[model samples]
Target: MDLMAMIENAMTSPVIYLAILALATLDAFLPFLPSESVVIAAAVFAVSGIPSLPLIIVLAALGAFVGDHIGYLIGRLLRERRPGGRLIRAADRIAPHLHRRGGALIIAGRFVPGGRTAIVTASGATGYPLTRFTFFTAIAAVTWAGYSGLIGYLGGVAFESNSSLGLVVGLGLALSITALGELVRYVSRRRAAATGAG
Candidate 1:
């Protein structure tokens, strides 16, 4: 079988759920992996009722939650090792802001491509409260999973006649959303900087 055929077969198989869980979990620290793409693809296939949509959302959220903690732990470990490390220094500089608006940053960063890892890791490095981090990260994971899955589900519904086209639409929508988010963040930062200068 060709690559696409093999992937389709796996998506239809019972193991697809496990695959989703694994990919989402790994993608937290390893942003290079295409966990979002996997989730989107599975969601696209879910329109046919092979893999359950609810299960996809739940597993994806759970995986993300677990993976986010791993990033936090890594940051904590790094902080313990190197008091003079650049990451620790950066975390120190942002510690006050993190305490004030950490939850918002944690939640928003989850949706950003690599922002999730950096923010969560910095949170840990800065010794942000565990309870607060857990609470916000939970929200982030669930919302992120829901948003991604829903986008794919919508694309699938729109292009039910063509699954391939549905996948393309889903991916395109995901990319567009990510890009929009980055644009907003950029604009917000620039405005904040300008205001600070003035």
Candidate 2:
């Protein structure tokens, strides 16, 4: 069988849920793993009813929640033991803004690939309130999971005859959204810099 067909068979197994959870968790800290794509693929298969869509969203959210907590703890440790660490230093520099808009930033960053890791780690390093962090992170995780899964589901519906094409469409949508977010952020930063200079 071809590679994709083999992968599709493997993903259809019962253990795919656990795989989804694991990948989502690792992607939070690792940032390089294609957890979003995996979720999208599973969701594309979900249209076929092999894996439940709601379960995929729930597991992905739970995994992201747990992984972010780990990142927070790691950042806290660095702040305590390595005050001069690069991440800690960076966190220190942005601590003021993080303190002011931590909730919105956390939620928005969760959608970006590496931005989530950086923001969560910085939040910890800066000792941002745990209560608020937990609340915002929960929101971020659930929203992210739902958004990713639904996008895939929609793609699958649009291309019901071709699951692979559905996966591509879902990924394209995700990348487009991320790019849009980056553009917005860039423009905001430029405006803020101009205001500061004025």
In terms of lDDT, which candidate is strongest? Answer: 2
Pairs that collide, model 2? none
lDDT of each: 0.89, 0.90
What TM-score does model 2 achieve against the real structure? 0.96
Per-residue error (Å), model 2, residue 113: 2.3
lDDT, candidate 2, at 78: 89
Which stretches of candidate 2 lie above 4 Å from their native place?
none
| Candidate 1 per-residue lDDT over residues 58-165, each given as its tens digit | 999999999889888888998999989998998899889888999999999888988888888888898898888999999999998898899888888999888888
